[model samples]
Target: MRHRRPEDRRPPWGVRRTVFSGLVPLVVLFGWFTLAIRLGLPSAEPVGFLPFVFVAFAALVGFGRWLARAGILLALLGLLPVLAVLLGGWTATGDEILLSRGKPVVVLVSAESAHRLKAGLAYTYDVRNPDGSTDSLEPGVGTRLPVGSQVTVVEDPDRLVAPQLAGRQDPAVPLVFACLGTASLVAVVVSTAVAGERRRVRNATTR
Candidate 1:
């Protein structure tokens, strides 16, 4: 078996340090903005702001190579909120401009299509609107509701994002994501604990 390297057994640097000045604020701003959108707050256009956040993530990762694991973890955790919002876990504020689906009208799904490749599949469909409108919807990840099936579609007059399938998502997608997130969190916690214990043992031996 391979032995641990001296560097691997050492503790990570503290979060408070002169070397991390430029990195901290960028992380806070992007994390706060993404979390705000995730919490069901209204934004005039939320998706449009992601490019800047992506740039910030890239810059932070490049500048903080010494803390690569921690930087990467922070960025990935920051994205959990955005993923939840996209997955329909939190889409409305109960006051989004008329709440077209408050009482939630259900209509026959007019058309449907799905495309598949090695990466994954994207599903979309059109549905008859509550007020006699035809809204095309690209809904959250799930089993695609078939054409001629009945589904509720939620839209806003303010048009913050795509019209969402009111309640047509398959239960499997969210369950899978929840499992993955929990596993990742557990792995992170266990690894940190092991590392801390190793550091303590190394210090005790030195004494």
Candidate 2:
């Protein structure tokens, strides 16, 4: 019965390890963003499918065994904006109700305006459109919203995910961002460390 030497056991597969490393972060991110959507993120614009593309890129590149860990870091760094944009979508979606309705949100205008919305609420900071045009103010929450003037419109009591305009705005967005960000960072760090350790082991065996 002959025992096989470590190197004789065949070089450890690289692509599989890298692919697995990339996938771990993606699954976590998907879960987070999905949950965010479920919680009803507000936005005036429709959410798009760009997040999946970047995540896929990260996963596929992780399988590039020829690349150094630093290269992997850069690849992952490039994906950050995609992730942020996706999360920004969630933020916008969750807040869209107010914006669409032109809800009055209290924003501090010049030093003289002493108006303040109730704490923990969402409001619109209506400003003149960039084209330097003005529209007649209507009788909605944001009606007569002046330049730099802030006002808080009453929150719709009916919707479950309606953003609170009076007490506690969307608090979940920051948490979701932190969770996803931390997970991505950890994935990169762990993958790099593992790659380094593997190189060390290989070197010892070859000596």
Candidate 3:
């Protein structure tokens, strides 16, 4: 038998390489999902998905055979959220959860406009805060409200997402969290589209 170098220990597709790098990470991924949901984690899908992506990315980039396999497992298991969201009858509603409760505040809209998005227009505004401070606020709705208008704005205490016009606050805000897991699915789809577009352009240039 011939002596091999340190790097030769993982022969890319050997039994040891597959077990340590592959099997262990899958176990970790399953644990993340099971424990995250059972313990009530925030954005449970994303919280679990990211670790696997990171580990697998690191492994593939040469952290060693076992670590790489683990990373691969994490990456593979991360797809659970994506599949569930896409196939499950989930729809993107007009409204999203802004805050647990709406705070009633008077805002003087010094400026407002409708900026066009890929699909529709979003209403953005410059409003005067309660303390007489200036700030930029967007109502995330479609409608024309001229400058110098006084309107009610509801800001969440946690400030998790953008504040909305007080009129837009839903009574169910405190009790609901829907559009379930659309974030990761949307991000993945957008990223894939961008990457594919770039690849197409690159291929076209070579011809």
Candidate 4:
């Protein structure tokens, strides 16, 4: 009937350790992504970030035994944002295809504004078309232009999509999201496999 020491009673994987294990990989991934974008690297697609994802998963598997279940859950949750971004990109692509058949128009930027997004700053311009019609155009994230600047854009004849900047259809933003989503799926699969193998080994040892 000896009393157990407090340290001995504590679980091997404490709350702080679990949190650190989970957050370290995420922080590292965020830093790498930001650096890639700043350096103008080819990070617009899922393939570009595959190496980083592999490293992240490796770290989790090697160092975070308790994190496998959490990783699977987080990975599943991550798919929501990926789906939303892909849906938006699909709609935009369809609009662009429709606008391509229409004539190009030169629009004057009447006003300019900047907004802060999660990734970075995005610019919006109030553009005046030749027909005296005005519309707001987003040139994309990290783009900036002075007011009164003239830009060429393809206008949709059926108004299916808003006027889009000509020669500026960069899929970087959407593809980045796709990369993250793919990484999450990979994490789920790897974590599940690791967990199952570990459980099988423990069962064999106990028997």
Query: Quick one: how many clashes does candidate 2 have?
Result: 21
Clashing pairs in 4: none
Off by over 4 Å in 2: 1-69, 72-145, 148-168
The TM-score of candidate 4 is 0.44
Against the correct fold, how does model 2 do in TM-score? 0.32
**Clash totals for all candidate models:** 0, 21, 4, 0
RMSD of each: 10.7, 13.5, 14.0, 13.6
Model-by-model lDDT, in order? 0.50, 0.46, 0.46, 0.57
Q: Is candidate 1 or candidate 2 better by lDDT?
A: 1
Whole-model alpha-carbon lDDT for candidate 4: 0.57
User: Per-residue CA lDDT of candidate 3, range 40-68, in tens?
Assistant: 22221123445544543453333222332
The candidate that achieves the highest lDDT relative to the unseen native structure: 4
Per-residue lDDT value at 137 in model 4: 77
Tell me the tens digit of each residue's lDDT in model 1 across 30-125.
Answer: 464456445433332234446645764554344333333345654565455334433332233323332443345576788887766354676767
TM for every model, in the order presented, reads: 0.42, 0.32, 0.40, 0.44
Winner by TM-score between candidate 3 and candidate 1: 1
Question: Alpha carbon lDDT of residue 3, candidate 4?
Answer: 89
lDDT of 4 at 160: 47
Q: At residue 144, what lDDT does model 3 achieve?
A: 63
